[model samples]
Target: MSLDYTSHSHRPEPDELVPSRYALRIGEIDVLVISDGVLPLPTAMLAHNVDPAVRAAWLNDMFLPPDAFDWALNVVVARSGGQTILIDAGLGLDPDLNLPRAGQLVRRLEAAGIDLGSVTDVVLTHMHMDHIGGLLVDGVKDRLRPDLRIHVAAAEVEFWASPDFSHVSMPPGFPDALRSAAKRFVKEYRSQLRTFEEEHEVAPGVVVRRTGGHTPGHSVVRLASGGDRLTFAGDLVFAVGFDHPDWYNGFEHDPEESAQVRVRLLRELAANGELLVATHLPFPSIGRVALDGDVFRWVPTFWDY
Candidate 1:
């Protein structure tokens, strides 16, 4: 459906008009950046391999709050012709997880003129809770959109769904009930979910690019229309401290791979000068990468909201 940006009625409220939720035009395609809300994590959770003093000093230099960090959860909603493609369902409500802002995904979709049920395809960058939780609704026992075509990285789904890893590598203390919910959802909806490798076109102008690191099968997405290009750099690159491109979250399955992939992707993005959607970057998470000396920086885009 063609969106009329002039219609204020469809826009989010002033309070919800975060820099993270905005629309961009790439040739004939309209890309709406939606928020799944933000996650507030303690400093300890983020201070993985870095020394505390170094981390604190870096945080101070970046002018970040000394106490904690706010990681933004952004999902891409791209509309062109009759296709309404959603990339990465946000984290849904999980009281046990103390996540209140998660379920904001669906609401943000409506604010952007996308009816959840009308979403034809959902491209999951990974199967992590934060990326797939919003695929279902709170208290709903069925697939949120029974007919929605869900595409996932074949290796990712296999790793997560494999029974062998359930008792071994799966994180301890994971909410039992939520795990059961995930298993049931996967069992019933597995038929609607398809897996792809390397490169595949989900739609006319949207393509999937597999970039593993954070997860064995994690992938990023690339959208191109005319000469304009946009890449959703999944978890390959974290927005921890925009200046600290080498910093990797402790949760990354393979920090070295994650960092390597991130650096390579950043160089390509910087060279091509394409717009990027960073899931963890400070709101609206759309930006371009630039080289500053030997390091890179995230240069946010200005959206005419």
Candidate 2:
């Protein structure tokens, strides 16, 4: 099948409070989550809990109605010392997908006052369609920033680039777009790609820690400099209530492994008193992890600014 470069069908209405941009100043680093837009999820996607009641209770507790699902994509951008870093580009223009918000990433970055050409690095937590889809533009032959050094997990590079996994399941209305995007990443951008092992430093004060389970190469970023710290948790925890360390989203490639990584990540987040920015969390998705004895909780920021 050929790739479908359609935009998402459901976009933010004119009056919608879409969070296109925000910034967190951590000493010298400025971290941002550029809004790519929102997505409507099938309510049944998370029906993986052992008990239907448990799942329903989670939904209710999270104030999510049982029959509907909605989510937003907030891709990360960090700027420090003249270097602009973007983590996980959003879905770009795709004709067949009919997704409304798919192609607004670059525009959102511009809204945030960032020039695509100034982006020095692109860090991909994993190669899921929504995460890596914006790595390339519609007809452009290279990344939004051709000179940027792209960093991805070694395992993710292998898994997503493997030709045998072309027919994996994607969300409805889109069939082979994810696989096509991955292939394009490998073919055209491979030379600019740098794969790293767990706990490796991709830059000064920017560490990539393997938090696999969402994907074999799934990871989280730890940004620490000058005694201040924050973590870009990626998809480790999806929404507000999944704050429990053991709460793993059902979309994980390996649910059990995802849960394990979540547990470790939440524990560390709680112990170190670090701020968190999750991709699938609420807009302006910056927060801090709190520990309640052995459990974990999320305290969203009043202002990431």
Candidate 3:
């Protein structure tokens, strides 16, 4: 058979805006998946072990941009036991940060009828800027919900708050400016910060589990109520990490530890069929992990218009 090689000049202009908020019901708890925006990271920064050609081929097979990878900033908002809880604050409102595509959490929250003051708690899954940046408003931190309690992993806080942290070399491809921003956030919330070690419940039905390696104190938020369960997997698996759990990203503080945690978490989620809410997955990033042979695969939940 012969194929037509003609091209059309009537391509539509790109639409950048997408429905950024999604409401999910997990038993008695109401969860909102709020999108700050998408970030385009260089693909070369993802897997350090894979050859350039193999990595490009892998990304190409998945129909992703071979040059840059699209990472979504999905924050979680949960209402349980009369408490409004925000999982991880999105990138803060800073135009100079070169993240103009992000920092939309506040606007999106208001659009969803979420009042910042009404949020009783803000959980920092890790000390990374993208996770805690939304805690600042107008380039200053005090303008945010000052009365709300901020939950952070003790290890994460100590690492970022250390005087030596600024002098240490950041992971490959990780921006140094983010370290400065993270320090500011830590100082701003230090008064209201409640650091937790090991597993503990931060809110009514929300439990924080220490899953370090991505950072010294990286954690995941687990929500369970009325037999329904959902996990907020913070940077545990991004893009192809599910299929290749050993693939180390340049952002990990401890690549080996990160891989171990990723593999362990993926196994548990895949076995139990619990909903996995990833921060850096595609927008509205709610899904289930399925065991594909010895590895795993992401099965995004059905989208409801």
Top TM-score prediction, candidate number: 3
lDDT of 2 by residue, 1-305 (tens): 00011112224346556546665567666676667887667544554444667777878887898866767787877766567778888777666677785557876665545667777888888877778777667654443566678888888888775533322233553435667878877887888898887767766778778778888898888888888898888888876334444544545777677778888777778788888887778777778888776667778878622
User: Can you rank all candidates by TM-score, best first?
Assistant: 3, 1, 2
- Give the number of the best model, judged by lDDT: 3
Of 2 and 3, which scores higher on TM-score? 3
RMSD of each: 3.3, 6.5, 8.5
lDDT, candidate 3, residue 67? 81
lDDT by residue (83-110, candidate 3, tens digit) is 7788999887666657778888887776
Please give the TM-score that candidate 3 achieves against the real structure. Answer: 0.89
Whole-model lDDT values for every prediction: 0.73, 0.70, 0.79
TM-score of each: 0.88, 0.85, 0.89
Candidate 1 structure lDDT: 0.73
- Residue 29, candidate 3: alpha-carbon lDDT: 80
Off by over 4 Å in 1: 5-11, 14-20, 139-145, 162-185
